[model samples]
Target: MSSQLLMIEDDTRLAEMVGEYLGQSGLHVTHRADGKSGLAQLQGPEAGPLPDLVILDLMLPDMDGLEVCRRIRSLQGPAAQVPVLMLTAKGDPMDRIIGLELGADDYLPKPFEPRELLARIRAILRRRTDGGTPAATPALRFGSLEIDRDARTVTVGGQVADLTSYQFDLLVTLAERAGRVLTRDQIMEAVRGRELDAFDRSIDVHMGRIRAAIEADAKNPRRILTVRGVGYVFAKQQD
Candidate 1:
């Protein structure tokens, strides 16, 4: 079956172009002009099946895209877990960071190539399906934290930890190589099959979010420790 995608964008021409382009690649694309209607479709009973992913624009006529992301994450049931790939014209990294903090699976700046968008979409969906974990062990335990590969869930102290799909995969990558310091490029390649941009701090932002979800003290994270000049390591010993 073709993957379903919802695009909440205010640009009519852009939406049409995206829809037609992605449709040719065996993806079903639905478009809404503003945030409210897009969100209503997700919340409405007649919205049919939930979309596999959402392509959201940062600037919207009705509401800010960040607010939309926050609301989506707050929704009950499967809708809340639907992966979001944020779009923004702004070059500011803060917008992307904020979106990630609010549970967006990924973000793309405007003026992006159609192929890159398609690639990002595929990567996110692929993570959801395979999780890139091929080990016989279905779960990994480190003190109070538990990562279940099959279920794609993380728990700390028996309580479910809320992490975006991308973050969860990142955690899994680090855990799979526990105690080994992985540079940003290595970690990004491991999880997403891509190298990190020289200036892209998105990985660090995601690590902070993961720490916030799983660590008792995010500022003093015990499970994921940052090396001064290199990258990050998933501590083998954790409480």
Candidate 2:
């Protein structure tokens, strides 16, 4: 089935633009110009053909974007699985951080080119479906850290590590292709299904957090080594 996308934005022009753009990219697009209506549509009893992703504008006339995000997350069963990508005019660093912390799969600042938005949508969707069986999962070990493919979880010293979905994916990607020098672009595509833009710092920040969780020290991480000009690699042996 073609991926379905739902866009919630009060701006009619922007909504139309996004719908047309995404539709052209082979996705079924459903749009709502109001938050209340959008929420109702998603929460409706019929639930015919649930959306694969939600592109939500932060400034909704009827409600705060964070509140809308919270509501979407509260849904049970299938509805709860939908991934959200937040759109906002505010380019504040804090805003982006908060959005990610709030369970948004991704965030895009306003005035972005339509193509970039389309790229992001495709990337997010691809990342969601890239996983395969057995051979696909990487067996990585750093120090006492180990990632189990069958279990789909990470453990440090045999204890489960509290990792976010994205973190786990990143770890698995690097672990599976251990010792290979992967550039940022390669890492981004493998983990996020897209290239890393010049300003995209989410991966680095995420790596830092992951290191903190798995490594005895994060300031100078060892398990995941950064090659500076290039990207990063999972060491063949614990350092």
lDDT of every predicted structure (CA atoms): 0.92, 0.78
Among these predicted structures, which one has the highest TM-score? 1
Q: Candidate 2 residues 111-173, lDDT tens each?
A: 888988888788777656654543564556667888976565799998877555567778888
RMSD of each: 1.8, 4.3
lDDT, model 1, position 99: 90
User: How many clashes show up in model 1?
Assistant: 0
Each prediction's number of clashing residue pairs:
0, 0
lDDT of 1: 0.92
What's the lDDT for candidate 2? 0.78
| Deviating ranges (above 4 Å) for candidate 1 | 131-136
Candidate 2 clashing pairs, residues 3+ apart or interchain: none
TM-score of 2: 0.70
- The residue-by-residue lDDT of candidate 1 on 1-239, one tens digit each, is 89999999999999999999999999999999998889987887547789999999999998989999999999888899999999976578889989988989999999899999999999999989764556666689999999998888999999999998899999999999999999999999988899889999999989999999999999998889999899999999957
